[model samples]
Target chain A: MITIALPKGALLSDSIELFKRLGLDFTAFLDSKNRQLQITDPTNTAKGLLVRATDVPVYVEYGQAQLGIVGYDLLLEKTPDVAHLADLNFGGCRMSVAVPKTSPYQTPTELPPNGKVASKFVNCAKTYFQQLDLPVEIIPLYGSVELGPITGMSEAIVDLVSTGRTLKENGLVEVDTLFQSTARLIAHPLSYRLNLDNLNDLGEQIKNSVSKS
Target chain B: MITIALPKGALLSDSIELFKRLGLDFTAFLDSKNRQLQITDPTNTAKGLLVRATDVPVYVEYGQAQLGIVGYDLLLEKTPDVAHLADLNFGGCRMSVAVPKTSPYQTPTELPPNGKVASKFVNCAKTYFQQLDLPVEIIPLYGSVELGPITGMSEAIVDLVSTGRTLKENGLVEVDTLFQSTARLIAHPLSYRLNLDNLNDLGEQIKNSVSKS
Candidate 1:
């Protein structure tokens, strides 16, 4: 039996829908009141575990769940040991560098030497600045990295830019895009090696469905 | 004028109540729909900046807000360069080491050498185990640390424990407490030094009200 971990909130519906197209009946697992962390599918050949989006890769890497769906931003941030099977192409966003709209530091070079750049994705920010050969401080913030620049805590912020509404409202403007992100289907290395045929079939089905949609 | 950063959710009410006792009217700032991140009192002698609980210390440490009310757990995790003023004593919890209820490792030492301990507080967990003279792997998880042991990602977890219901439900048990935690008042170094008299007066008012309550 193959167990899959699905992120609970915004990504849940899309994951379930994708699985359904692959002939997997995951409806019972979607019941809001179930409250059960683990639920067995009607066929009992697969199980679903609801978890926080960021923890999806952790579960897959540990082999608790053979498969998972998570955002690419998380993959860049944590860099967990998991096989990046296929891009599901949903939950699209861009990881970008932002600064307060009123800041004098518009370009990356304009930033003061060794000025701090706050972000939830500390690793991503580090890599981005390193690629630019810029030595800057990365201040890790769990939420609202937009407020970092607005409050002068950091000269700039590296965070996900979706519709740009959040940054605009926070008086921040996107300055540089680090990466384009979407949800990806990931699997444990051991699981992929052992159940190659079944997992590949599942992966192929998801890719076909996603392309058609 | 004095600027204070208050956490947005559970701790907001208690923080406002504490400030009100000092004759600082902060009710208008408490409205959930205000959308304005910064709001001033009617008299303009003080202003409130509502921010995510986890970012409270960041604002204060950066001098964006002179003072902040935040959980002690965050303070331990971040170790910001801020004055640890009076312990507000609310939001009480413990940073605990937990493992599967059935795990054979009863004590921290009984666990396999070089075993992993997962937690959102990566730095805190690393420091705790390092002090125990254990060579343990620290897996940084953003949420659901209980799943670490259940999924075999880590032999144990270090996380915040309040009611222990979450752990119990996940078939995990607390093994040891790293530290006892509560909400605290933190201030930037320069702010405390510059506004020494006013800050002390505010701290005294809060301490008095806390004792009376």
Candidate 2:
């Protein structure tokens, strides 16, 4: 059986729809009252493991699940050893360096040296600043990163921006965008190589579903 | 005015009640519909910034918040430069090493060498394994760490255990507990040293509240 690791959150509905197009139904996760993390389709062709978005890649990398659906940002941040099969293209967002609207710095490079910047994506933020050769402290915060600048704890922050509403509501402005992220189809390397349980064929069918969408 | 950073979610109500006993109120955060991240008590003697539990110290260390409340586990993991003032004694939990109930290893050292052990507290888990002279790969996962063993991605997982309901549901058992954790009061080092805004007095009041409770 080909078990799939599906992320639990905003992108869940889109991910379920995509799999539905591939003749596998795992939409039980969309139910508000559904607490089950693991479910199997009526056809028994596939099993879905509802998990945190960040853990999707980890599950696939370790061969627990032959396939996974995850955000590109997580792929970049986690850098798991998974086969990047196709771009599912639903969860569109960008990672950017943002500062309070009233700040003097307009761009990331314009910010002062040795300043503190907070983000949940520490590695991604660190790499971006390192590429610019700007040495700054990247404080790790798992949530409400916008609070960093508003509270004066951090001069800037690097975080994922989706609707841009959160930033505007918090009185912060994007200084520079590091990358755009979207949902992608990922597979375990060994599973893909061995083509176990028709894994390769199922991968192609999912790719076709993406193209059709 | 003294700016206080209170953690959001389960700890917020208790934190606010503790502060209430100390003569400062921040219960606005407990309102279900409140979207405001920052609020001031009617007396205006203090301001409260609602933030993630992990970021509590970051705000305190930067002096954006002269005082903060966070879980002891966070203080242990982040090790921010803040004055550990008092323990509020709520939000009790423990950091533990768990494995699938079917696993043969009964102790951390008995687990397979070089096996993956996932946890959000990377530093703590690393230290625990290192002390046992057991070299294992510590995979950092921010949420739902119990899935690590269920999916066979990890032979073991080191995570926070409150009632162990999640682990029990996931067919995992606690092998060893690293330490018990509770809510703690912390302050910016400089603020504590200078006794600004009657910081020392406020600290005493909070300690008193804890003792009285």
Task: Give the top-scoring candidate (lDDT).
Answer: 2
Candidate 2 Cα misplacement greater than 4 A, ranges: none
Q: Show the colliding residue pairs in model 1.
A: none
TM-score of chain B of each: 0.92, 0.98
| TM-score of every prediction relative to native | 0.90, 0.95
For model 2 chain A, the run of ten residues with the poorest summed lDDT: A204-213
Tens-digit per-residue lDDT, B109-209, candidate 2: 88889798989999999989999989899987768888777767789999989999988988899999999999999999998999999999989988987
- What tier of docking accuracy does candidate 1 attain? medium
Q: Could you say which candidate leads in TM-score?
A: 2
Q: What is the Cα-based lDDT of residue A165 in candidate 2?
A: 96
DockQ of candidate 2 relative to the true structure = 0.71
Q: What is every candidate's C-alpha DockQ against the true complex, given to 2 decimals?
A: 0.62, 0.71
Q: For residue A72, what is the lDDT in candidate 1?
A: 90
State how far residue B132 of model 2 sits from its true place (Å): 1.8
Poorly placed runs, candidate 1 (over 4 Å): A28-30
DockQ of predicted model 1: 0.62
Cα displacement (Å) at residue B208, model 1? 3.9
